[model samples]
Target chain A: MKAKIYITLKAGVLDPQGKAVEHSLHNLGFEGVTGVRQGKYMEIELATEDKTKAEADLDEMCKKLLANIVIENYRIELE
Target chain B: MKAKIYITLKAGVLDPQGKAVEHSLHNLGFEGVTGVRQGKYMEIELATEDKTKAEADLDEMCKKLLANIVIENYRIELE
Candidate 1:
């Protein structure tokens, strides 16, 4: 099984990288773009097929190491 | 309108960050997890509502800035 994790910055977290990218895009002639926010995408493959254990493990992984919890939130999609 | 972009490393590229995360997970007792890959996720808000223009612009953005054509590939989802 595989799990896709998306980690996004919380609202009002001041995304400097996103701002820089947006500026670059506009300078590159992509004038219609705005409000850019950047985050993390992770793909994790599991050796076990137990859905219950996977969910429990994923939650623990996110809280412990995958996310900041203070300024970021993570969502997991199982495949 | 909004667009979500995902930037991922192509196969055969080194992922030191992902490897470190995997090691940490294993040390933390998440033994069933393996093959971790990390990437970037971005959300861009567009001022225009034209879907065709958005697609065209996004392609340019990915090629010119969002992705390193040599080692990464980007996918965009519009909403």
Candidate 2:
């Protein structure tokens, strides 16, 4: 089984890195760009095919370390 | 309009960061996790809704900045 996790900042949180990227894109001649938000994506492979177990484990990982739950949100996809 | 970008290391490329994360996950008790690959995810908002133009611009941005084409591949999604 494989798990894909997306960790992104909460809506109200300030993202300095995203702001910097937006500014760089604009300066790079990407005039149409108005905003940018940056996040982390992880692809994990497990030896087991248990989707239920994988999802639970991934959720735990997210809450424990992958994401700062106080300021970030995480989404998981399984395959 | 919004565009989502996923930048990942190409197959066979060494990812020190991913390895470290994998080790940390194991130490953190994510036992089911066997392998991990990490990447960047970005969301961009544009003033224009023209799909064709947005795709072109994003592709250019990926080539020029968002991704290191020599070692990474990027996928773009627009909405």
lDDT of each: 0.93, 0.91
Docking class of 2: high
Tens digits of per-residue lDDT for model 2, B1-79: 9989999999999999999989998898776678899999999999987889889999999998889999999999987
TM-score of chain A of each: 0.96, 0.95
- Give candidate 2 regions above 4 Å deviation: none
Clashes of 1: 0
Residue B10 miss distance in model 2 (angstroms): 0.4
* Model 2, global lDDT: 0.91
Instruction: State every prediction's TM-score relative to the real structure.
Output: 0.97, 0.97
The TM-score measured for candidate 1 stands at: 0.97
